[model samples]
Target chain A: MDSELPPLLVLGPPAVFNIFKSQYPHKYRFLNAFSSDLPLLQFLQTQNTHPSSVRAIFCNQRQLVTADIIRSLPSLGIIATSTVGYDHIDTTECRRRGIQIATLGSQFAADVADMAVALLIDVIFKISAGDRFVKKLVPFKPWSFPSDSKLGGKRIGIIGLGRIGAEVAKRLEAFDCIIMYHSRNKNPSVSYTFYSNVLDLASDSDVLVLCCPLTEQTKYIVNKEVMLALGKDGIIVNIGRGALVDENELVQCLMKGEIRGAGLDVFENEPYVPKELFSLDNVVLSPHAAALTLDCFMDSCRHVAKSLDAFFSS
Target chain B: MDSELPPLLVLGPPAVFNIFKSQYPHKYRFLNAFSSDLPLLQFLQTQNTHPSSVRAIFCNQRQLVTADIIRSLPSLGIIATSTVGYDHIDTTECRRRGIQIATLGSQFAADVADMAVALLIDVIFKISAGDRFVKKLVPFKPWSFPSDSKLGGKRIGIIGLGRIGAEVAKRLEAFDCIIMYHSRNKNPSVSYTFYSNVLDLASDSDVLVLCCPLTEQTKYIVNKEVMLALGKDGIIVNIGRGALVDENELVQCLMKGEIRGAGLDVFENEPYVPKELFSLDNVVLSPHAAALTLDCFMDSCRHVAKSLDAFFSS
Candidate 1:
C-alpha cells in the first residue's frame, strides 16, 4: 500500500504470495500476478506504473520463471524462490542477464531430511503397512505381517551428502546405522565412507537414499543397474526429485521384486503417480511434500525475505 | 533333543517357538507346548516325563505366564521372555517363588526407539496422511493437504528415561528437538529436564511419548486431565504398553480434538483397534509390532539363550 516501498513481483498463488507480503509488509510493495485477470506479463506491466521499479521476483515451486518472463522484467535484480531446488527458474537466462538468485537453501534441509529418514524407517519397518493391517482388522496369525529389517547397523548409502543428506546421517547415527555416501566429491570432514559411483554404493548399501539436486548430469541417476546392484533385500528412499530415479525401472523393479521396496515422496509426474504403485504393499508413497510443513514454509518465507533485504541493501 | 541337556519350556506358537529352539538347539532340550495336541498345562506335564527337570520357561508376548503356570512348573528356576516388557509374567508370583526372571532388556531398545521416532515423525509430518493423499489421487489443489508440524525445535516430553526412552531422546536430539522427560525418579545421569508428574510434563510438551513400563501406578497414566493439559495441538506416541494411556479417554480425546493426533503401537485391546480409529485421519495405528523386526526377534532369541545359560551355570 506504500508507494515509496520498492515493487516486488510475486508469481505464486495468493496463499504463498500472501505470506511473503505479510512477512515484509512495509519493506516492499507486492504486485501479485494471480490477483489480476490479465496475463502475468501484462499484469506485471500494468500493476506497477514504473515497470523498472519491480526489482525482485518472489516465486514458488509451482510457477516457472521462464526466459520470456525473465526477459519481461527488465530491471529484475534478483529472484528469490521459496523452495530448496531452483530448477524451476531459467538459470541460463538469469546468468546471461547477470541477475542474482537466492534459494531457501538449508532452511528446508532439516525438514526434508526428517522426511527422508521418516520414509526410510517407514519402509524398512513397515510402519504404515502395520498401521493398515491393524486399522483394517486383518486376521491375527503368527507372523501375520512380514518380518521387518532393523535400522541399526544397516549399510545406508546416501546419494549426495549435501545439507539434507548430512542431517539425515546425523539423525540416523543415534540408531547406530552404518552410514556411507556417494557425492560429487568426497567430503573430507565427514568420516562416512564415500563411493565414487552410485553402482558401487548400491552394491554395498542395504538402503539407498536420494538427496542430491536434480540436474542434467544427475537425471535418472538411479537406473535399472543401480536398482539391481541394490539387490533383492535393498530399499530405496527418494525425498529428492522423482526424475533422479528411473520411475519406470523403479516400478518394474518393485513389481518383479528386483529390489525389496521403495519410499517415494516425489514421482516422475507429480500428482500423477503410477496407478500400479497404489496397490503395492512394499512401497510407501508421499505427495511431493517433504518440505510442506508449516515450520518449513514459515522458515522459507523468512529466508526469502532476508534474501530480498540483503539483495536490495547490496 | 538330547535327554541329558536341561529342559526349557516354550509356551509360544510353533512358528515363534521354532525360532527360539533353532537359535540354540544344542544348549537346551526344548519342550514346545504347541508341538503337542494337548492343552499347554497338559503338554507341560505329559511332554516332559520328568516335570521337575523343566528349569526354564521360554515365552513370547502372546502367551501369559499365569500364577498357575508358574506354580505348575515346580522346579522352574527362571522365566526367560523374548520381549522387553515382562507384564505377561506374574512378577508377584515369580518373586514369591524365588524364581529369577530375565527379559530382552536393552536388546530391543534401539529398534523400539527407532519405531517411536518413526511414528512421531510420521504423525507430526503427516507422512502416512500424505502417502494416502498421493495414493488415493486426491485432486491436487493448492494447500489440499493440511500443513504439518516440523520435528525440530518442538518440546518433546518422554515418559520413562529407561534404555528405550534414553535412546529415543538421543535420536531426537539430532533433530534439534528440546527433550524433557518424566520418570519414576529423576535420572541424575541424563541431562534432560525431568518433570515429577505426568500432568506437568504433558502441559509443557508438544509431544508426549510413552516409553515407561506399565504398572499399577502407571496404568492409565495419561488420563483426561493429562490429555487436556497436552492441549489441542499436542501429539502422543506410545511405544509402551496399551493400558499406560486410557484407551477410552484417548478415543474420546481424538474424537473431540482434545489432542492433535496419536501414533499408537499398542492398544487396550490389540488386534482389535477401536473401529473408530479406522476412520480418523489424525491417528496412526500400528499392531503392537514396534519391536517385531527380524533383527529384534533374533536378538531376543540370543538374549533368552544367554539368560538360560547364565541362570543354569549360576
Candidate 2:
C-alpha cells in the first residue's frame, strides 16, 4: 500500500516536516530529508528507489531549496512552498527546469501585517521599553518614557502594495494614518497616494513599512540615502525580508539617531542580530517569526497539501 | 496687569504644569501649585489673594482634585481635567457646589486605542518575548518561540463600547477580528455583536479588553468569576484603568495559568507594579501610559485651554 503512494520530497527544517506530516493527506509518502542521518544529497543518493519517483517537493521558509536539489530530482514537476515569500527557493533554477511553483498566496498576510503594525506601535509608544522599565527597578515616568509621537494621522509609506502590503495599508487606515505606497505599478483599484520612487516615498513619510519581495532589483533597496531621506523622526518596519534594507546602514542610522528607530523582524543574517541593537531602547528586534502562528502554519500546511494533490491528480 | 487676567489654578505633578504652561492662553494667569514649596492645601492657604479670586482649576491625570480642595475654593466655577476619565476629581463635591466639570472628551481615544491593539498583538505574537530571546544568547527557534495563536478571527470581547473601545473595534476589524462588546448599553452606532452580561461575554471571548472608565459600578468588573469564564486560553488586556479588574485575582490567574496572558497599560497602583509579574513572559506591563504621546498631550493642552476659555466667556 505504501509503495502505491506517490513519493514527495520534504525539504527544510524538521519543524516544517512535523507540521506538514500532521496535515498532509496520506495519498503521498514523504521522503523526509531532515530526518535522515546523512546530508540531504547523500541521503537521496542512498535511497533504493529511483530519483525520478519524487514528483513534488514540500519546502518551508527556514530552508533554501537550492539549484542542486532541483537538478538531483528528474521527475520534480512542482515545488510547493509553505510561505508567501519564495526568495529562499531557487526560483530561477525552477523556472529554467519548467517546474510549477505553488506559494501560500497571502494566507499569512494578516499575521504579517498585524506584526508590522505591532512593531510600529511598539516603537512609537516605547511599549517594550516601558515594559522593561516596569519590570526593572527603574521608575515609571510616563512623560519621560514615551515622549514619542502617536500613530494617528502620520504619513505611512508602504513598499509594494502586494497581499501583505495591502493588508498593512488596510490596518493602518483604521488608525487614521495617511497611507502612501511605492509599488512596481500604481494599483488602480485603490486611491492611496502613489510614489513611483522609494526615495521620494521615504522622504515624505513619517514611517516606511517594507512588505515587498526580496529580488535582484529589490535587494538593499533601503540604502543610506533612503534612510537619510526618512529623517531623524522617521521609523522603518521591515516584515518583508532582512535584505530589503542594508542592515549595517540601518544599525549605523539607529546608533547615530539619524533615523529615529527601527522595528526589525528580519535581519541580513537570520538568528544573528547585531549586538548594538540590543541596548538601544528605540529599536525593537524580533527573530523572523511573524508568520509562525499556529493558525498560519496549519493553513500553510493544508494549502501545500491541497496544491500538490491537485497538481498530481490533474 | 497680572490681576487683570483671570486666575486659573493649576494642579498635579510638575510635568503636567510644564505642558499646561506651554499651551495655556495668556488671558488666564496660572496660580501654579506644583512648583510651590508648600503642599497643595498649604500653598492655597499661603496665597495672598482671596480664595474667591480663583475661578477655574486645571488638573491633569496625575493629580486628584479632592473634596477638600473644592471646599477650599469658594469661587470655583469650573474644573477642567486634561484626560478622558474624571474619577480622579471629586465629582460628587463638584455636583453639590454647582461647579461645572470639563474633560478632554475622547481627544486621546485614538492614542489609547492604538496602545490597546499594540499590547494585544505583542502578547499574542510574543513579539517582546522574541526580542528578549534574540537579545539574549538563546537559539532562535521559530516553532518553539511563537507557539501561540494568531490575532485574526479571534472572538474579542470589548468591555466598553465607548470612544476608546470603538476605536479598538475599528482597528481590530482590519485584522479580521470578530469584535464583541459588553458596555453599559448597546451602542447603536456599531454593528458588532453586543452582550449585555459580562459573564456571557467572558465565556464567549478568547480575549477580553477593558477600555471603559473606572466607576463605582464598573470597579473590579473583572473578578475571579470573570477570569474563570474567560478560561485558560483567554487573554486580558487592560488599557482602561487598573481597578477595572481585581488586580489580586488577575495576578493569581496569571500565576496559575488560569488565563493565558495579559497586556496591561494600567495598574491599580501607579509607578508600582506587582513584584510577582516581573519574571513572567505572558504579561506585558506598561506604566499607565496609553494616552502618553506628544500629539495626544498637545491636543489635550489645547482642548483644556479652549474649554476653559469658552466656560469663562460664556
Best by DockQ: 2
Model 1, position B300, has a per-residue lDDT of: 70
B237-301, model 1: which lDDT tens digit per residue?
99999999999999999999999999999887655678888867678988787777666667677
lDDT of 1 by residue, A116-234 (tens): 99998889878777766766633444445456578888899999999999999998887889999999999999999999999999999999999998888889999999999999999
**How many residue pairs clash in each candidate at the backbone level?**
0, 0
- Show where candidate 1 strays beyond 4 Å: A1-9, A12-15, A21-55, A137-148, A309-314, B1-9, B12-15, B21-55, B137-148, B309-314
RMSD of 2: 2.9
Clashing pairs in 1: none
The local distance difference test score of each candidate is 0.83, 0.85
Which digits, one per residue and each the tens of the lDDT, describe model 2 over residues A1-314? 77678888777753455777776557777787767788666787776557788889887767788898788888889988877888988989989999988998887888889889989988898888877778873454433645657788889999989989999999999999999999999899999999999999999999999999999999999999999999999999999999999999999999999999999989988867899998888888887878777777777777877898799988
How well docked is model 1, in DockQ terms?
0.60
TM-scores of all predicted structures: 0.89, 0.91
| Candidate 2 Cα misplacement greater than 4 A, ranges | A1-8, A22-32, A35-39, A45-53, A137-148, A311-314, B1-8, B23-41, B45-53, B137-143, B311-314
Question: Which candidate number has the best lDDT?
Answer: 2
